[model samples]
Target: MKPPPFSYHRAGSGEHAVALLSALGPRAKVLAGGQSLLPMLNLRLADPPHLVDIGRAEDLRILRRAGDRLVIGAATTQSEVEYSSLTAAVPLLAEAVGYVAHPPIRHRGTVVGSMAHAAAVAELPCVALVLDARFTVLGADGVRTVAAGDFFLGPFRTAVGPGELVAEVALPIAAPGTGQAWSEFSLRRGNFPVAGAGVSLTLHHGRVAAVAIGLSGVADRPVRVPSAERILLGAVPDDELITRAAAAATEDLEPRPAADPAAHILPVPVAPVPGFDYRARVARSQVRRALTTALARAGGTR
Candidate 1:
């Protein structure tokens, strides 16, 4: 079905985009990449009265570094980042991009748009959580920076208040001796994982100096497991320790179905969990696998 009627405004710059959104009110939506918004519009899941197209906003089409963090603009496509030098600073973000749908989608899908979309199985949000990515949001009031933990409110929700749009995101560069790994179980190569795990491990003096674990498809929103992270920090992870950490990560993760998917009318996509126990098992094993790989790459193990 075609999307309902709407007024379109092509923004020439970031400030223009924000001003357009501010004037349009809450029912208005910012359009970038159109990878997520278009489909939702066509299905009538979202019927915004106005669309502020920022895809042509040159300022938001940037990819650069800020000191120790890699910054990505709102219009920067995932494919752009995947093949850019910025990935050298945060390889985990690049690896996660490879798992977001397929080549064509990534070519047109904006990274910040995916974060704003806030899909349950999206990999970017999970990676952002682990990498300490900061979202810069622009509104009529002004720009504000938000941490990943505070940015993601829940499934299909975010801290981006109405009249605000994400302008860019900054992800910290991994420290030396750090190993990053992403492990997920998807039915097909590009399909969203039923359960996914991301891990970054920094080894110093043969022990874990710093670590972060991010999980997707196991809960309502992409989440980081500090309980598991706490167990491995400053420790030499062995099989037993890894197993315990994995178990702790999934222990209280109540696997629930995605909800309020008004955009998907195709009999509702299959829920990620067949049984809660089975889903937890998959998520736990992913964490375990990610930890092992990260440890090996960090030179903590053979």
Candidate 2:
């Protein structure tokens, strides 16, 4: 399939890209990695009249540490984030990036693009939620920051308005005693996961001091399981506690309609969404598995 007829506009920098967007209004689409945008265009899922290319945006290629946050530019590919020294700061993101399809895709897909293109069914957005990542948006109105929780509205949807483009994503550095783990259910590596979990846990004195649970393929968007986190806080992570927490995680899953669960991704299809009971069961199990691994990494027993 081919994309709809469109006018191509090239921007030399991030600011230039924003200016183009302002002029084109919502009819223009910004092109960075083009991994997701091109596919959507080919499928006619996105029919914008203008394509604003930002590939030449040098300032938007930044990857650096701004104090405690590891900042990644909109043009920063997944490969760059995966291999960069800055990855050490957000281990969960680093670990999850490996599960984002194959190296070839990673080499071309921008981390911010994936975050903007995806909801909960993909990897980066889920990791964004778990790490409390922040997105910087630039527009004619000026700049504004959006938290991951508020940024992800749904699949291929985000807080970025028509004239605003996401310039960068910033992730908080993991504190001492923090341990991260990622898990996904797929018949093969690089395939869209049937379900997945990303966990960040901090243990102190054998008890959970802090934890964040990010779940994918369980709902319309990547989400944090606060109820599950509450179950583990200040408690020794054991078989019993983990079991209880995992069950709590299930309470938060709102499965897609039974008739067409795959419709959540629209032009793209994911693993068939299972029955409500099955999804709840898988969510519980994955949370248990991730928490167990995270606890071990945090130097906790069981």
Candidate 1's TM-score reads 0.94
- How would you encode candidate 1's per-residue C-alpha lDDT over 131-199 as one tens digit per residue? 888999999999899999898887678999888989999999988999898999877898777778999
TM-score of every candidate: 0.94, 0.94
Best-performing candidate as measured by lDDT? 1
Clashing pairs in 2: 120-222
| lDDT by candidate, in order shown | 0.84, 0.83
Compose the digit string of candidate 2's lDDT tens values, residues 39-131.
778888789999898877888898999999999998889999999988988888888899887999899889998897875568888999998
Model 2 TM-score (2 dp): 0.94
Candidate 2, residue 178: how far the Cα is off, in Å:
0.5
Candidate 1 deviant stretches above 4 angstroms: 255-273
